[model samples]
Target: AHIITAVIGSGVLSLAWAIAQLGWAAGPAIMLLFALVIYYTSTLLAECYRSGDPETGKRHYTYMDAVRSYLPGTKVKLCGVIQYANLVGVAIGYTIAASISMRAVRRADCFHYHDVRGRSGKDSCKSSSNPYMIVFGVVQILFSQIPDFDQIWWLSIVAAVMSFTYSTIGLGLGIAQTVANGGIQGSLTGLSVGPGVTSMQKVWRSLQAFGNIAFAYSYSIILIEIQDTVKAPPPSEAKVMKKATGISVATTTVFYMLCGCMGYAAFGDAAPDNLLTGFGFYEPFWLLDVAN
Candidate 1:
C-alpha cells in the first residue's frame, strides 16, 4: 500500500500525452522499460537495507542513511541534496496539479449548468486557480502537522485506494471514448511532422515524453523510508521488500498501460496533457468531475 501510494501519482494523468508524442510502438515499450528499470533498482535498494546481514543488521532508517551506509563521504551529502530537491519539486508539481483538477471540477459543473440554462458558460467560467491552490496548501499544512506522518498506517491505505479509484475511472472512460470514436485512432509512428507541428517540435515532445514517463514511475527516493515501516522479518526484509515492490510495480503498470493506451486510442495525436481534466472526456461531466 505504501509503495502504491508513493508510485502512483498525479503524473499518471499526463501519460496519454506522453504516449501520443512517442506514438504506438515506442510509448508502451518505453513505459515497460521504465517499469523494469525501477523494479530492478528497487530490488537492489532493498538489498541495501541492511549493511552485512539480511536479517540481523543495522537498519537504514531513511534513503540518505542507506546512501551514507553504502556510499560514504561527499557522495552522501550530494545524494541528500539532490533527493530533497527532487522531492520539493515533486511537492510543487503535485500541488499545481491538484489545484488544476479542482478547477476542472468546478468548470465541468459550470458548463453543465450553463448548457442547461441555454447560456454561454465559456465566457463566465474563466477564473484563477489561486484559491484552489491555497486550499490545497492549507490542507497539506494540516497533514504535515501530524506526528510521524509516514507511519500513520491508514494514510497510505487511503491514498492507495484513491489512486486506484481515479485510475480505474480513467481507464473505463478511455475505453468508452475509444468505442464512441468508432475505432482506435492513433498511428504506429505517433504524431506526424507537418503543418502545425515541425520536426523540431516532434523531437522535443518525444524527449519530454521520456521525462514524463520517468516521472510517473518515480518513487525510489522514498523506498527506504517505506521499507522501514515493515516489521522485522522472518522471511527477510529484503525478500519482503522485493515481493512488495514487484506487486506494486505490476499493479501500477497495468493501470498505466490501460489508461495511457486507451486514451491514445481514443484521441490519437490530439490526446490532452491530462486525461481527466484536459477536457477530452467532457461528457459524462459528472464522472470526469469525480475522477478529477
Candidate 2:
C-alpha cells in the first residue's frame, strides 16, 4: 500500500506528453529503462535500511539516519538538503496539479451546461485556481494533523485505491478515444521538425521527456521510510521491502505503459501535458469530474 501510494503520483499524467516528445521508439524504451533503474536502486536503498545486517543490525529510522549511518559527515547534510528540497518541489507540483484538476472539473461542467442550453462560446469558463489551491491546502493540513499518519494502516490503503481509481479512469478514457479515432496515431520518431516545433525545441522537449519518465518512477526517496514500517525479522525488513518495491514497480510500469501508449495513440503528437485534466476528452463531463 505504501509503495502504491508513493509510486503512482501526478507524474503519470505527464507520460503521454513525454512519449509524444520522445516518439514511439524511444518513449517506451526509456520508460522501461527507468523502471529497471528505479527498481534496482530501490532494492539497494531498501537494503540500506539497517546499518550493518539484513535482519538484526541497528535500524535507520529515516533516510537521513541511513545517510548518517554510512556516509558520516558532510554528505549527510547534502543528502538532507537535496531530499527535502525534492519533497518541497513535489508538494508544490501536487498542489498545482490538484488546482488544475479542480479547475478542469468546473470548466467541464460549464461547457456541458452551456451546450445543453444552446449556448456556444458565450463563456470561456475560465476561473482562477487560488480558491481551489487553498481548498487542497486545507485538506492536506487536516490529513497531516492525523496522529502518527505513517502508522495509520488504512491511510495508505485508501490513498492507493484513489490513485488506482483515477489512473484506471484515465487509461480507459484513452483507450476509448483511440478506438474512436479509427486508427493508431503517432510515428516511430514522434513529432517531426514541423512548422510549429523547431529542431532545438525538439531536443529540449526530448530531454524534458526523460525527466518526466524519471519523475514517474521516483519513489526511492521514501523507500527507507516505508521500509521502517515493516514488521520484524522472519522475512527481514530488507526482504519485505525489496519484494514490495518489485511488485509496486512492476504494477506501476504496466499502468504507465497502457496509459502513456493509449493516450499517445489517442491524441498523437498533440497530446496534452496532462491526460485527464488537459481537456483531452471534454465529453462525459461527469466521468471527467469523477476522474479529476
Candidate 3:
C-alpha cells in the first residue's frame, strides 16, 4: 500500500499525452526503462539501510539519516537540502495536478448541463484552478500534521484505492472509446519518428519524453522511508523491500501501459496533457472524466 501510494498518482494521467509526444514505440519503451531503473535504485537504497555485517547496530531511518551515515561533511547537508526541496516541489506539483483534475471535472459538468438544456453560447461557467489548488493544499497540510506513521495507515489505504479507482476508470474509458471510434487517430507508424520541423528538434523532443518517463518513475526518495515500516529483521528488510518494490512496480507498469497506449490509440495527436480533459463533453465519458 505504501509503495502504491508512493508510485501511482496524478502522474499516470499525463502519460498518454507524453506518449503522443514521443510517438507509440518510444513511449512504452522509455517508461519500461524507467521501471527498470527505479527497481535498481530501490535495491541500492534498501542496501543503504544497513551497515557493517548487516547484523550490526547501524540502521538509518530516514533519507537524511542515511546520507549523514554514508557521507562526509557538507555533502550530508547538501543531500538533506536537496531531498526536502524535492519533496516540497512534489507537494506543489501534486496540488496543481489536483486543481487541474478538479477543473476538468467542473468543465465536464458545465458542458453536460449545457447540452441537456439545449442552450449553449460560450462556456459561461468560468472558473480558475486557484481555489481548487487551495482546497487540495489545505487537505494535504492537514494530512501532513499526522505525526505518527502508524496513524496514517488509513490515509495510505485511501490513497491507494483512489489511485486504482481513477486509473481503472481512465483505462476503461480509453479502450471503450477506441472500440467505438473503430480505429486510432494520427499516424499508425510504429515510432513517432519526427513530428517536429527539424531532425534536431525531433531528437530534443524525444529526450523530453525520456525525462517525463524518468520523472514518472521516481520514488527513490521515499523508498528508505517506506522500507523502514516493514516489521522484519535488519537483514530481512532488504528482501521485504525488494518484494514490495517489485509488486508495486509491476502493478503500476501495467496500468501505465494500458492508460498510455489506449489513450494514445483513441486520441492520437489530439491527446491532451490531462487525458480526462481531452475527453470534452462526450456522453458517458463525462462521468469517467469527473471520476478520474
Candidate 4:
C-alpha cells in the first residue's frame, strides 16, 4: 500500500493521464489488478505488523526479517546485494518516470510563458504533478547539451535496459497496476453517487475509496485472509491493526492530494517539465524569481 501509493501518489502525478491512456474499457481489469496489488501489499504490511513494533524487541514478517528468519546462510550477502539493486532500480525508475512528466509540464509552461503567455486556463497542464515529472525536466536540458554522439549511444542503452527490466513478470505486473489503476479521477468520475455534483458526493467517493483500502469493510476479509496466512496475528491485535492501517492510508492520501494540488498550482505544468534543469522549473515564474 505504502510503496504503490507512494509511487503513484508521489511518483506518478498524472494518475488521470495514465488511466486515460489505458482507456475506459480497461477499468474492470485495472481494478482486478488493484485487488491483487492490495492483497500483495496487505501481505507485506501484515508482515510489518508481525514484527513487533519497531520500538520493541520482537519481530514480525517484514521482508528482510522474513528472509533472515527463513533463509540464513552465507548467501545472506547475496540477499543484501539483491535488496540494494531493488532499491536502486526503484529510485532510478521513479526519478526517470517522474522526470518525464516534469519535462512535459515545463515544455507546456515554456510555451505558455514565452510563446503563448499564461492564458491556457482550463487547457493548462494535467494535474498529478508527481516527482517523476519533475526530474524529467532536468533530463530534457541534459539531453540537449550533451554531445550528440555519446548521448545518443547512452539513451539507446538506457532504453534497452529498461525494456529488459520490465520484461520480468513482477515488474510488468507492478508497473501496469500502478500506472492504470492508481485512482485520481476515479475518486471523482464513473463512481456511483447521488445525482448531480455535490460536496456530499465528493465526500462519499473519498470514503468509498477509503473503504476500498482502509476501514476493513468489503475488502477486509480477503485482505485479512492473506494476513492470517502471513503474520497470523491474534484476534486481540485487530484494534491496533485497524488504528495503524487507518493512519497510514489517510496520511498517504492527504499527502497525495496536497502534493498534486500545490505542485500544479505553483509550478503548474513546468514543475514536471523543467526537472532536468531543475532550475527551469521556476523560469516560468519570472515574477516570483524577481521578487525573491
Superior by lDDT: candidate 1 or candidate 4? 1
Across 1-292, the per-residue lDDT of candidate 3 in tens digits comes to 9999889887787787778777776678888888988998898888887776554548788888888888997999899889999898888888788887787777777777787888876358567999999999888779678778455668789989988888778787788778878997645433345454566755676676676667677788988888778876744777788888999999999889998888888788667666665553256745656465
Query: What is the C-alpha lDDT profile of model 4 across 1-292, one tens digit per residue?
Result: 3222222222323322222223234422343454455545654555443444433435533345544654667566677677667656555655755555354545545545654553545434444555555556577567668674432435434543432332222222223333454432332133334556566755654444333232211232233322232233344334445544555444444433333333223332223322222332333343222211
Higher-TM-score candidate among 1 and 3? 1
Residue 141 CA error for candidate 3 (Å)?
2.5
* Candidate 4 deviant stretches above 4 angstroms: 1-22, 39-41, 48-57, 60-62, 74-82, 116-243, 246-292
When 2 and 3 are scored with lDDT, the better candidate is: 2
* Clash count in backbone of candidate 2: 0
- 223-265, model 1: which lDDT tens digit per residue? 9888988889797789999999999999999989988999899
Q: How many residue pairs clash in each candidate?
A: 0, 0, 0, 25
lDDT against the true structure, per candidate, is: 0.91, 0.91, 0.77, 0.39
Distance (Å) between predicted and true CA of 67, model 4? Answer: 1.9
Every model's TM-score: 0.98, 0.97, 0.90, 0.37
Q: What are the root-mean-square deviations of the candidates from the true structure over C-alphas?
A: 1.0, 1.1, 2.5, 16.2
CA lDDT of 189 in candidate 4? 33
Model 1: weakest 10-residue lDDT segment is 119-128
